[model samples]
Target: MPITTEKEQLVAELSDKLTRTKGAVLTTYSGLSVAQDTKLRRKLREAEVEYRVVKNTLTRIAAAKANITGLDKHLEGTTAIAISYTDPVAPAKVLSEFVKELKGKNLEIKAGIVEGKVIDANGVKSLASLPSREVLLAQLLAGMQSPIVGLVNVLHGTTRNLVCALEAIRKQKESA
Candidate 1:
């Protein structure tokens, strides 16, 4: 079958998005009101995630073009993709929080891809449970500094004790 220019454009655009995204969450947004959808979009936008309803077939083509596999099964249903280029956890975290806020009313998470690896819904939730990248990095830095800080304190204490002993000897000699 000859491909239409419009479809080719769509495929190209989606392929580019898929290729560039660090993470993407597939969701079923059926039965959501316009207000709810807008709110969701706004939240996702603030998190620097792109949320858009996607045609399943076109997305499948795009996924193939982007060399992403294992996305076909989750592509069914009322599909919208939340993609983030900067933070792999942003989409999952934002979507999970939004669904929790809605009390799981209209939006249902299907699956997700992180760093090019396809993960299940539970995996997506686990990813969302993690702290943000900055927080994790901070924690790691603190962890790395802990031993050094302890060592410095130990050295300082030893030097202080030696100085105190020397002062006591000097005082004894003067008294004698």
Candidate 2:
């Protein structure tokens, strides 16, 4: 089949985005109201995630071009893709939160890809359950500093005991 230049461009764009993103969440927006969809888009945008209602065929082609597979089976139904370029869990986290807020209505996750690994709804939820990048980094930093902090406290303990003993001795001498 001869491809149109416009479609080629669209596919190229999608493939580029797909190739660059760390995670992609495939979802259905079937029964969401305009207000809810707008709110979702706003939230996703704030998170620096790209959300698009892409044609399944174009998505398939783009996925193939990007060397991403295993999500084609999930391309069925009213599919919209939420893609994150930096944070691998942002899209999943946002979508899962939104789904929960909506009471798991029309807005539902189908499948997802995180760091090139395909995952299902449960996997996406699990990913969402994880802390954000900043939080994880903070946790790592705390972990790295704990030993040093403990060592410093341990090193100070001898001086503390010495000072206490000196104070006690001084008090005893004054009493005598």
Q: Mind sharing the TM-score for model 1?
A: 0.95
**Which residue pairs in model 2 clash with each other?**
none
Q: Ten-residue segment with the worst summed lDDT in candidate 2?
A: 68-77
Residue pairs clashing in model 1 are none
Mind giving the per-residue lDDT tens digits that candidate 2 earns over 1-176? 66799999999999998888899899999999999999999999999999999999999999999998797889898999999999999999999999999999989899999887789999999999999889999999999999999999988998899999999999999999
Judged by lDDT against the true structure, how good is candidate 2? Answer: 0.93
* lDDT values for all models: 0.95, 0.93
TM-score per candidate: 0.95, 0.87
Which model scores highest in TM-score? 1
lDDT of 1 at 71: 91
* lDDT tens per residue, model 1, 51-102: 9999999999999999899999998889999999999999999999999999
* TM-score of candidate 2 against the unseen true structure: 0.87
